[model samples]
Target chain A: MERIKPSLQLKDDIDLHISGWIVQRIGWVLLLLLLIAASLGVFGTGWLSAGHVAGKNGTVSFERIARFETPMKLVVQIEKADGDIEIRIPRSYLDCMEIDKIVPEPATQKAAGGSAIYTFDAEAESTITFYLMPESTGSIHTELTIDNTNFPIAHFIFP
Target chain B: MNPVVRGVAVYLFLLVVFRIMGKRSLSESTTFDFVLLLIISEVTQQALVGQDYSLTGAFILITTLISLDLIFSLIKEKFHLFGKIAEGVPLIVVDQGKPLTKRMRKCKVSEEDILEAARFHFGLEKMEQIRYAILEKDGSISIVPEKEKASIK
Candidate 1:
């Protein structure tokens, strides 16, 4: 009986493939890091993408990171409402997104002073959710006014 | 950056990803391997063309991919070490009717796989009939029949 020996007289670098394997391991590590970042909301869908803006009268919550043409939500919770909740947002940023719907339809909607204003009938407290799809891919800067309290908002859209 | 940049980035990314996945994965040995390759290409299509739908974008992207491939091929030609690292060398898992267990294990090749290749290619039923079983770089096993090999110089 003869024992088979492994030999490739041509050219075999399998034994000396250490550096290449190390580079491959580094790539795997970097990919793991990227996936972790994505899971944490860096790409768009996780806790990291969720943002909150607490104003004096209420709080505004929205997605900090979003994809172009992807659907998202903007929530406004009115802590104190006198009679009607007047929500105003700059037309510049409003134009950047297509508002598909607004829950509890506003009683009045109009564009004034470069801002679209929505007047909603309210009680002591209520929440308004804006269903939006980002139309453009870039940084979006805008301001929102909910019953005299203002909140400056920003969003980054991935292409 | 130009739309060509999009093509370059996507092509390079896919290259690195596929390389790390190993040569065997891309050999398309099984049905699932073929399906996986299809899914990867489908996913890459969006990033390759992006928002550009014009003829210019198409031409640019096509050229970008082709150019990158040409550059890699050229690099492989100029550097022997890089070529070996990029594409592994062929391995002989069996020598003169004896199965090299260590080499076969290291290459993820099994005894069954070698005999299957032998039967498929040379109609040899046993390991003794296999003079040489070579695992090619493309992940295919090639069998040399002992009857004819013994007569060859």
Candidate 2:
């Protein structure tokens, strides 16, 4: 029997260059590193607190811009002078942000303007904190009403 | 983000990541590979749903992923180049009873792997008894026995 020598010629010439493959491998590694960094809050814009206090009914303050998928703190301080008041925040906020944890979980009531009203009895000056994570990017504009005062809060989520 | 959009994004991301990992990564799954797959799925679940755990959200995501997979299959069927790029082409690791050492090394396949496949499929004892051993697109070894050896068997 005649011995047949092996042939390595493929029907179609495919680019099997190790350099090209290495480049693609490096690209994916960099992408994964960037994703991990973002998740760890590195290379992320820090919690941006809205300096403007809308103290129409009571002093209500929170971070204006929340970084995408990054947890942030939202604080609302109610004055003793206001007594017991209902704070209304737009329900649409839930679409863009996930509430991880909230301090002093108050009794919630449904309100107009697609908002959820949280009733807080201010025997003394009270502060509530909300840990929030922004889900999407772009501008989020919503109205937060305290008692009869409506405060329009607008923030841009960084991608 | 919409569940459908989130699903598509996750799917694309996973596809790219796995593609970079190479075909063998999917074909050969050890115990550690199974654990890695579970971890990957858990992480993907969080990214796909965010904080939305509603049944509706889950349904939308499942539908979107399936639809995208179907669309890609159709596209692959229509375009040969796309199919090649997406699934890769079958490579000849052993030609005419001779092992292609360079190609096998690049593909992370050893001579032992081909020998094992040959032994399993053809009851062949040596590499010389095998005519061709192809590293398939799906990461399987397809063995073709030598004409004389096959006839003798």
10 residues in a row with least lDDT, candidate 2 chain A: A1-10
TM-score of chain A of 2: 0.62
Highest lDDT against the true fold, candidate: 1
TM-score of 1: 0.76
Off by over 4 Å in 1: A1-9, A16-18, A25-33, A91-125, A134-142, A156-159, B50-56, B95-107, B144-153
Per-residue CA lDDT of model 1 for A1-159, tens digit only, reads 123344435444445444555666787788899999999999886899998999888999999999987799999999888899999988888789999999989999999999999999998889999999898888998889999888989999987
**Candidate 1, DockQ score (0 to 1):** 0.32
When summed lDDT is taken over every stretch of 10 residues in candidate 1 chain B, the lowest stretch is B144-153
CA shift at B133, candidate 1, in angstroms?
Answer: 3.7
